[model samples]
Target: MPSRSRYDVVIVGGGHNGLVAAAYLAGAGRRVAVLERLDAAGGAAVSGTPFPGVAARLSRFAYLVSLLPRRVVQDLGLRLELRRRPFASYTPTVRDGAPTGLLVGDGEERVRTSFTRLTGDEREYVAWRAFYARTGRLAGRVFPTLTEPLPSRAELRARVADEAVWSAVFERPLGETVEETFADDLVRGVVLTDALIGTFAHAHDPSLAQNRCFLYHVIGQGSGDWDVPVGGMGAVTGALLEAAVAAGAEIATGHEVTGIATDGRGAEVAWRTDAGEGVLGAGTVLVNASPSELARLLGEPGPPAPEGSQLKVNMLLRRLPALRDPAVDPREAFAGTFHVAEGYAELETAYREAAAGRPPTVPPSEVYCHSLTDPTILSPALAADGYHTMTLFGLHTPARLFSGDPADRERTRERLVADALAALDTHLAEPLADCLAVDADGRPCLEVRTPGDLEDELRLPGGHIFHGDLAFPHRAEEGEPADQAERWGVATGHRNVLLCGAGAVRGGGVSGVGGHNAAMAVLGR
Candidate 1:
């Protein structure tokens, strides 16, 4: 039971976003309460020791910090350190029967040499630099607007002040820009990968879904750099949990919000616990759940099920796997994103196959070794013994492929894992399985999470990470309501109900913008 039956604000879902809202509102002297379904509060932004008795805590679901703003960190006084990676990305490929790779952001001279080796000239390298410089400028101009009220299309375009850059990213399809800017298939793929992360869209998607996804990935805190949290991702949520609790917010876990009834002025939040059912009255209800889930709770027909389009695999390696490209050290290659079978053609082919209801012949994926950047997640002994962690994200593996008869789904999972490893093995000197760290039970220290598994465990409908497709931070091109709540981008059909989760505008990745904007709307800022 809560401290009282009524609260100034009742927040449903204790994900990092919810905690952010709780901390801000509670600190402002508002009576706040956060109800979570799970026993924990972090939601997807959590770390767990997945392998039994492994003594290594892995960032189970979401990894890396990109969109978190400095303002939120300072406002909450959070104790967190985000370390930048020295290398940006490494993509392995073969040219004319010889094995080679391109390493970006390692060093200017080295990157130029690698690009020349792969493309037979310096034109591709020059184009790559010029293209990113354009995005960098766009990031600087647009990222700060995310935490504030929604910007009108015209206002954002004027703020950018560069019609060409704005039109390339916001107006036209992203694939057109990539095709016109760069000629090398591999380089183009690396740039376009940002657009397709967790999104089941092709490069030329007319809806500009890929453009929206790419914008969020590139506009993180005015720098597109994705930093590693010192501790696992849990450190992020831990800091939020601390701030919220210290501010006198009541956090009740294991209480599932079952229903919400609002009548313009106030809202009633009905929840279920192991013991029984209860209701909490709130002058304002902040829903941190997905919009589809919110519709279900409200007894309304939600949109079609959202299908997540990525396969996540977590592995603990006794030692880093050897690379086929001997010039680049394995440490450097794994430090940043390692691109495997992700050339532009490969990505398109995979998308076509997945759209046709078949698994990709060659899975396009990227691997990240967080331990190389932040070793605090590992035990002292593991860190000293050359042990490391790898997170492999395979694109174009939609949830539809994994949802079917139980036996068929199992077979699909096995085949997808094998295909992903095979794609990675093309760039490795030795089999990746050889580097596995076995647990006390003698099982391999690897875990595969499919969309179905995530849906069952995390209550994520169709396992869509951003709750559904991501929306642009600004108001739509058609038009938007001029009301304050509408301008804040947190309004719901009900006057007193607001969205404060990934389903909200400007919500995606691990950013707490949704929560902050919702609080601002409630406070009438």
Candidate 2:
């Protein structure tokens, strides 16, 4: 090994979380450095020129941004340039020869009725809101104390006192809860779909009721608005990178970290950069990659097995689909997020198929046309000239490709894209085939993602987006022992090393809480 040059801290993976941690540590007058495997800072939250003249988000994976803590943004001074707009989701159902379903209002309305479909009654919307308010207050009592080392015995007792709040909330399955709460099937279905996203659980499954509460815990309620960052989701990370740089943090990209060397007091990280072998030493090391990726960086036998599974697909479209909704103005369609699951059974069946490692014949998908919301992110005037760039997220798709062969993977990708387009057609009735933008050679338009590609290329464990399950074991829930929180946050059996990725805490989305909390722990603050 070369001579070790020490710093106050070292963060692994330039994903938003790692960047967030580095920024906070640097803000506190500590010398910090961030190491990213990819050439860019943002991992999934990025926009790039994959093809010449085509700049789009790599996965367009994350669409909504309500759960993120505003305190982090304000502390980092990121609110100045960050642009956001209120967007609501639409769940369409064909009734009396016309489509109709509940349109969840932004913020508290969204949170209150998140599980409305499962409740089966509109009246349950109020109950759902009540549940969120109760749970959030309980969470506040615990989460602030969870950012550091394990809580003391007294702290654990105080946090658990709030556990009684969830007693009535977790009494029923999410589907049952919704049915008992709402008289509307469409509303129940919409809420159930939200609970099942990125997981294998069915709506009727026991112990899944808490999943709805879990989802609400992360959502922003006070403002009650689900907004997309201006420019693109990439802009969020770009702003974070800028903030880190301003805070005196150094970032090195395209430098893949191969291994982590650690002792009780400090650590040495090895990476392969263009400049040949590079090593950095520091008293603290934070890993922002998925749990599995982090384990791989530590070599085999690193950490526990990953929890749950995830699959994502992104498409570059030639034009926007003409959906049948008077409320869906062409401009607002992209401004809002759309869900394809019509009912609870539909969402349940999709999750069942995904759990069985088989692709659903009609997969539930979430489609976002960024050009519809922000024209600036696309090539010149794509949104203005009646052309828009779109991305489709097929939730709960098979993590394993049907066939091990490369040809089979390609076929599966086509099937998934076709299913998403077909689902979009049900609501839009637009001929997606008419507008085709192909390569110079004039081939059919293509969708860009494969299960095999995500697992084999992106190194995602079972293609899970959050890198791990967001269940209690992985999440920072109250009543848990202090040692458990430490294991969940930074310490992973390796001394002087830590974890700061989505897998560590909130377990997905662009929220930098995990990163910020990890930095606080390492700094002994």
Give TM-scores for every candidate, taking all chains together and pairing residue i with residue i. Answer: 0.98, 0.83
The sequence of per-residue lDDT tens digits that candidate 2 reaches over residues 145-192 is: 434445544554456475454443334565665676555656566556
- Ten contiguous residues minimizing lDDT sum, candidate 1: 476-485
lDDT of 1 by residue, 10-33 (tens): 999999999999999999999999
Q: Which residues of candidate 1, in runs, are more than 4 Å off?
A: 477-482
Superposed Cα deviation of residue 165, candidate 1 (Å)? 1.1
RMSD of each: 1.2, 4.5
Per model, state how many residue pairs clash: 0, 17
Best by TM-score: 1
Candidate 2 whole-model C-alpha lDDT, 0 to 1: 0.63
lDDT of each: 0.91, 0.63
